[model samples]
Target: MTNQDSKVLRRNLLAGSAAVLAAPAIVGTALAQDKVTWKVQSHWPKASGSFNDSLVALAKELDTRTGGRFKLETFGAGEIAKDREIYNIVRRGVVPMGTISPAYILGEAQAMGLFYGVPGTLRETWEMLQLTKNLGIEKLVNDELAPKGVVMKAEKAYPTEVVLRRKIASAADLGSLKIRSAGTMLEYLAAAGASPQQIAGPEIYQAISTGVVDGAHWGAAIGALSMKFWEVARFHMKPALGITNDAWIMNKAALDKLPADLKLQFLSLLEERYFLRSVEYLQQEAIALNTGKAKMNVEVVRWPDDVLKKFAEASTGILKKEEAKGEISAKGTKALIKLMTDLGYV
Candidate 1:
């Protein structure tokens, strides 16, 4: 075929694929005979509580809903891919799919920080849901990731909380202690005057248990309870940080192999899981906090009004700084500012 003809055919193929993906997902149960099972590497460790269970639930539900024809076999953190490297692994087809935090890849894709979590700029789960679903955070992330040959469909968003070895009265106290953190929270912590270190998920427990770091912020109460961060750090801070550090990413080539009908069904499952997981984790956070207080002897510390004021000032500054990162980051920052204004936060 001529070069023009080849270009036309490729455009047609791409358009056809887009149509299939854009179709309103059919919510009914229908199975195909493809018999495809993709090995999925999880960013969460098997020992992690609901984090791992949530993945297990997805695998089982996918199997049952697809009549056992489409499924996922999950491997925990570092089993095949480290938490930070899951995106690269999934893109390279080392595994067809994996969980990754956009925060993990910001060194190269700073635009994704909008999806991972923007500390201080957003507050409350409802605010985040609004930003993601209505303010274009989700679509923006999907669009930016397309050129990189990876597709993100779901999320594992929860709070980025801190548990310190000792309590402090204000944000100024943060400067005296070293903390284990990651993503935008680490940036926020550092800007707020705390010494923050980016450590992998699995190593956080040991890091806190020993004197490597004074304390850490993983995922609020649930994340702390997952690895029992309470045992090492006796003080848990209240009013946890923003909910983020999550994206369910997959290899485009592997996703394209599925028949159109199954593809829609699979995407629907992910959307459903996102909604369910949001509620599940929120509930789990409350329960985990209770468990820490009653059974584990963890003291919950509520920062003073002045300390909250300090954090807000620092967080707003960081959000403004994010706008300088890139085009998508700026767009996200703009959307968040509008949302914050609408909510009377600014």
Candidate 2:
């Protein structure tokens, strides 16, 4: 072989290697250009609490992690659809994703009440997470929810307290007052003689102020302060109504359209958000309670021991009624009861 032949062979080998290395970059750039953007609506209005802030942060993190190939546009309650309508809207693909409390949809599926944290069960976030993760409650819920065309990605549990326009020293007092509430909590309140009405979060202040309802079993301390619940309701009832779970769900069809890598990225971000935000919720709750009492003049009232016992009894009855509805409700109720029993709550 001549020197010219050797030099040509070396040049060809180098060119082939460069082409192989460039393939991935070329493909990646093309994929990047085909970016996806999804709209995510939350049940809570924008800036309603730290939880809402966390949603915004999740969107920004997803964008960064996906190299800007995937983006999320988030809207708070009433921005795109009413809070109760979000589940159907997401399922219909009107918007690709949304956050909601399963309890809000209990009318559609009685079993969904189990996912929202039973009125007298799952006292803490970790306990609820354990029931959902270790005890297979999460799988049960996803299996049920998937058939409806919406997929549950993550669940968030946060504590809530009751706010009242009129002071109540005992559970019996609740019966004399009309209260705004929903789900099993409403049922329990009714058993105690309270006239329980369903009211939207945005409407609670007006309802209480204008004598539409005497009080509300509303959101966490921070959320009530955000909505100025204290302006109408001066008393903040403690021993939290139970930590309820809010679901972050996506349109199954829309999620299926995501590339494999993007889907993994989205799920990973959700897990991160769940753990971090859980901690942030407690911190913000403390701040809200302190600020509400000091600056807002919102007084904390502890329910009497007898009243709590009565509430617990009523809660058990409501769970039994829900369990009797159907097989799905029964299965969910059994799982919850087992957890509560194990934790000595039952």
Candidate 3:
């Protein structure tokens, strides 16, 4: 791939997607000849490279596959709505669809965290995918979201890595340090005896630089590299927390209006590309680690087995509380425990 094309592939970690299409219909049935274009708002800047290109590619696929009867226009984060505002805009149909992290909507239902990234779980992308499927997470979250006028679909899954200015060699390394974090991971970090704070994305670089926070669990290598986290903190924690999952959040009513054949085509593309997107993030993450080390003098820390064991223990405590959150969370927790148990981590 060309350098520019490769850069596009290097920068996505928490990215996700879903699309919508509609045209005038005869008695509620979409007409195959009708042309329609819907707008998609990204959760990151155009500099996000592959995260942005992935959606553009999806849009192109939709256009080519449907012979131009369907099209989507893409916009970067904040062009259509602020990151936190994407769910509302997409649901209200102010924009047909937008990229979002389920992390932002834990209030909609705590079970949404199952999709976001439940700490103490396996870090591998495929293992997490299996957890999502086994728990019927898609059905659970969408069941809540659909009635609210939104439908969520994940296009890719990538790890949320951590960076710190200090050495992290064991469980003691986790003690009393303030870290910027969000979602359920906060609870896990707290359980590990670390202080987790909520800081705006734009402020994180400065927060670390000024000792406002010791570290942050943002995106993986490529994403943190994009944010220049290495300038302030060189240790990039390895064995990422886990691949965070969000979605191409779409207006449910608009998507429901899609023709059956066209709808099938959309789903076919989503299914076929699920694993591909995860692998892309994984490959790009590896490249990013090399780039950061060679060009930016970044360091990688592989959390030891004992520290990881303490984490698993702490994760179970938080998992029980997660189970108490609601019905779906309870079921999802059981699935997490069952899987983790089989893997000998719980």
Candidate 4:
């Protein structure tokens, strides 16, 4: 009875254990082989600026990191949905992800306007970065956006400047100008006596050329140059309107469905690229400014101190108006004001 039966029993147990251990590896391999391609719709065109360029680079990096198991196809503004519709498109899963300016969706959530770097608020890139990273603004923003079925994976910011076809040196000059802008800045500009219109990216060039609008607020120096804004507008206003920040968001359901390891890899890669691209943009802005002035012959105009003061006052008034509309807006605006005040920005 004894030795032969005992040896056979031991061999059978070991074989079963080996098969159990090997099963998971086989399953993992199969899962990895099942590829996924997500479409990312962006509010910026492919050649618009560094932000869009970074997005393109990220898509390629995603393919490399996942060994081509995961891929991202990015579409520029107006290709899938207009800039203002990106948020809803991602929410409805028409696309898995999008690059959106929270300000564009102010109608959906009044608080979102506060998240896009309140006009006349933090002008420095470092300050804006700190607000999103260290001041908890990112959490407040995500808290509001998540309920709408989108999750912000990363934040991208760039310096902003106003481009004008006609010369404007002071607040008084604004009264005669009609400008195109977005977010709360429109309110601020209107308060300063300019007629503000919300124009989509593709229309700005024609708007400036055909005399539909005298000027427009756009991304930093690099952004303007990339879009060839100088061709239509000769003046670039200095002391940027604000450091504009937008969220790179994903469909909550689609993101949650990713395998745990792939999810981690995706987020990690996005974060690293976001940081590197932000730094690159800062450098590019400087180069663009110099190039715009020297090579492109674009005029740089600085608003008078009194005029700038009025803009700050207008921004504050608009912020208070928005804060009064809803609890979320109130909380978000209060937090940002407190942060800026504490940091000596106000």
Which candidate number has the best TM-score?
4
- Native-to-model Cα distance after best TM-score fit, residue 223 in candidate 2, in Å: 1.5
lDDT of 4 by residue, 192-212 (tens): 778899999878878988999
Error of 1 at 172 (Å): 4.4
- The CA lDDT of each predicted structure is 0.80, 0.79, 0.76, 0.80
Q: What is the TM-score of each candidate against the true structure?
A: 0.87, 0.88, 0.82, 0.91
* Model 3 CA lDDT for position 44: 62
lDDT of 1 by residue, 1-346 (tens): 9999999999999999987876644322233466888998887877777546578888888888888888898888888988678988888888899887777877645557777778766667767767777778888777877778888864656777789888888767777889998777776777667898988888988888887899998778887888878898989987776767477889998898887877888899888887788778888889999999999899999866665776787787778777898888798889988888988987
lDDT tens digits by residue: candidate 3, 1-346: 9998777666542132211222233434545666778898877666554455478878888899989888889887678775678888888889888877787788886578787867767767887777766557767787887779988877677788889888776667787579888887787677667888987565778899999999996677877777778888898887776667757788888887877777778778876566677778788888888999999888888876766676677777766777898887888877877887888865
Model 2 TM-score relative to the real fold: 0.88
lDDT of 4: 0.80
Model 4, C-alpha of 295: deviation from truth (Å): 1.6
Q: What is the alpha-carbon lDDT for the whole of candidate 1?
A: 0.80
Compute the lDDT of residue 302 as modeled in candidate 1.
84
Candidate 4 stretches greater than 4 Å from native: 1-17
